[model samples]
Target: MICMDTTTAALTRDEIARFHQQGYLGPYTACTPEDMAAVRLRIDAEVLTSTGPNPASPLHSRHLDHRPVHDLVTLPGVLGRVRGLLGDDIVLWSTFLFNKEPGTPEVPWHQDIDEWPLDPPVNLSIWMAIDEVTAENSCVQIIPGSHRELLHHVPSRPGMVFSKEIEPGLVDTSGAIDMELAPGEFFLFSEQLMHHSNKNDSNRRRLGLSARYTTPSVNIRDQDSAPCFPGHACVLVSGSDTQGLNRMTEPPA
Candidate 1:
């Protein structure tokens, strides 16, 4: 997952302050309709179809092509926010898509840091919507100002999983912020913040991409790199970057 260097924008002091204060920020848009459509079409055409109870609810790890997702993760604005959250020393650690198909099981309430083992638990997920998502269709629900607490738990299923449970002492936000958005919109959230979505009952499929990035300062040698796809390889499809850090080329499918 290579990306050309682009002029990096630091998350504003205010935005950083806000993220620290709230569990998440957005319903923000990161790509144009056509760009998003191209990615969705590629996903539809290339996904290896499957069906079953995915304990990693809301996500399908095996049926995806990560190379295409690289572009989305490295967009200048997206990267800027990430650097703001994690700092400039960054590396693309993993990527996966969670498609909440109609009638799928509900995404139980949880926190991202609990799901992962990133010590010092400072990370964010850029959740991009591939379809229109809403509370009715099981869009994301977040507990505000909850990232301050560290959590404990097991997987979403009996088998090993990536999410963690809210510690017995913490408050849950699974019923808060019934927010949704159209395709191409996204949100940036802390791994420590408690959040989850509902089962999809609408006629439409609620597909979304989750791309994870780590700060250069963080030691990622032991992380789960297996589920990540080479999704950031096309970071500069719209133009060229003068900075050496911006040179990712999209792979031919």
Candidate 2:
């Protein structure tokens, strides 16, 4: 009989080994069609009322009420993959509804851990695409195994390819993969990896729900605290062990 438990349903050995070697896995589909519909509805509500980009946009923070995005936080498969990476003592640290409208500028090349205040730098980001994400429309570019190396990079121009111009001496991105995700598909990656997205030149807008998870031992800073939706959310799913995972309280910051 097939075991239907999440912990045991963890990623396959090849998957785990690949992640260890490459530092990221998937385009994983965690949400069902119905779930995707619900998420789109919720995001639509925010889009309808929004005056500008979501707070987590790094460039804009207007009309930041992203409460409608709470569902992705409680998603089961997402939490499972997260748990498989970090073990059972997880504490959600932040959430952000990341969006890039047509003509949006290119995000600078940098590691997520560098932007946030954390020690030992062990955290994962789950980037969930709510719309079709393609290389033509400003897809995310990641350094395949850069998570193993730590490099310092200056911020790029608001809408320019900072990585291309300065990355030669700082870090090598030759084997990097430009991830293309569909609605309901997401990628989980470590914060140490060098990653950035180009300006969205496509006619359609590109939207992703980026959620950050940290171990309980990781300390939270006060300033960074206000940015993420506050509070702890625990929605029990399968298994006797909820270790290292649970629902997120805020949408991506």
Candidate 3:
């Protein structure tokens, strides 16, 4: 599958190899652009203004309460690729809407390993665009093969979206690639992959939803944690979670 719109999202050997070498894959179609338009309308009406489970973070865990968000999070084209990478058992530990309106500051150079917390510190994230993401609109950029090494992050500069960021000197900007994506399209990357979005330079807004997936084997810390607060729940997105190592919940009806 060379990034075509196919129901069977199984990866070819070459694709898997490329992912291993480069640390990311896609801009694959998960749903029709028209369908994403409908979802976007609902998100603007219901999700943007409403408070989710985490009061401090309004965009966290909308999949637990919003059916549309859950549907998009578990879309076959997207989840199938995840299943192809992460074996049979999968759990959606968290989903968050990343909306960057015009003037949204740069998200700084950082690996998600610093932002995302898990016992193993490994997970696949599918970031599906809700609004069309373009390089001018601050599309995510990544350094190929950067996931192989873990870098130190210091406190971020003022107006940055992240709390901590890798010092500019530590990252090699020469190989950075832009991950511009269309609405309903997504890319999968390891949590340790080095990625960031620049300041929005265009008038158009950029909105994307990132769903975090992992096998049930990884322990998602609960109750007063950076990744999980009280009332956190992980959805078994595919196959059997016989391990039951984390708190599981049903998707919204």
Candidate 4:
């Protein structure tokens, strides 16, 4: 059962079943576009330029240092849906600010579970669009039911965003679905889901934030901050971390 306050929108059993079957759910509305416009202003004014908690990437883990990011990560609309799958206790392990400018190269298909350092690699990720994401601007794409199996990955070619990617020829994305999102819209996906994005063909920039959550029982590589994670402070977003398995931090004050 989803553990959440009554005010939060909880997913129904059928919705939960579909998520497990398809490895994803939604294009849920987190907020009105106008409100998202206001939030986007704060993201631009206080977030994008800042080096955030993970200054190494300058784009990861801002939830630890920026109120806007923390708020987004803990938003009831998003977190409520996630509780259906991640259970009562949710610990946000990482948040990545994906800023794709014009001419950005494609992010080749990959499974997040393989790249993540967490033991057992159980993760529920929510990707929320902060700016309008369209097909031309390279919105995220995914293969349904792909999470049922983990594909092999190899060294990536030049110009791709990631250093490694799912080996070529193994993926058949002819049935892939492009996840076009509007501002304040978000989708919940499994860490094992196969997802990628094409190069930005338009002049406009696309901004999105990917928040990852797991239970406290899973081990975190909190000290090995590299690649993108810095400081790696996990925030308990729901219920309690009775397992006491990882370091926890309060939301940005």
- State TM-scores per candidate: 0.73, 0.76, 0.95, 0.95
Clashes of each: 25, 10, 0, 0
Better of 1 and 4 by lDDT: 4
lDDT for residue 188 in candidate 2, whole number 0-100:
87
Task: Give the lowest summed-lDDT range of ten residues in model 2.
Answer: 1-10
* Model 1: lDDT to the true structure: 0.61
Worst 10 residues of 4 by lDDT: 1-10
lDDT score, candidate 4, position 58: 74
Which ranges in model 1 have alpha carbons more than 4 Å from their true place?
Answer: 1-10, 48-66, 154-164, 167-170, 221-253
Between candidates 2 and 4, the one scoring higher on lDDT is 4
Instruction: Summarize candidate 1's per-residue lDDT along 8-98 as a digit string, tens digits.
Output: 4566788888988996777666776666787788667655353212234224432223455656666776777777776655655445677
lDDT of candidates 1 onward, in order: 0.61, 0.64, 0.87, 0.86
User: What would the per-residue lDDT of candidate 4 be over residues 139-163, giving only the tens digit for each residue?
Assistant: 9999989999999999998999999
Q: What is every candidate's alpha-carbon RMSD to the true fold?
A: 6.6, 6.1, 2.9, 3.3
Report the lDDT tens digits of candidate 3 across residue range 1-253. Answer: 1123457588888988999999999979998788788889999999999999887888988999998998887877887888888987898999899999999999999988776668887699989999999899999999999999889999998989888999878989899999988888899998889999999978999999999999988987764576677888889989988887888889887
Name the candidate, 2 or 3, with the larger TM-score value.
3
Best candidate, lDDT: 3
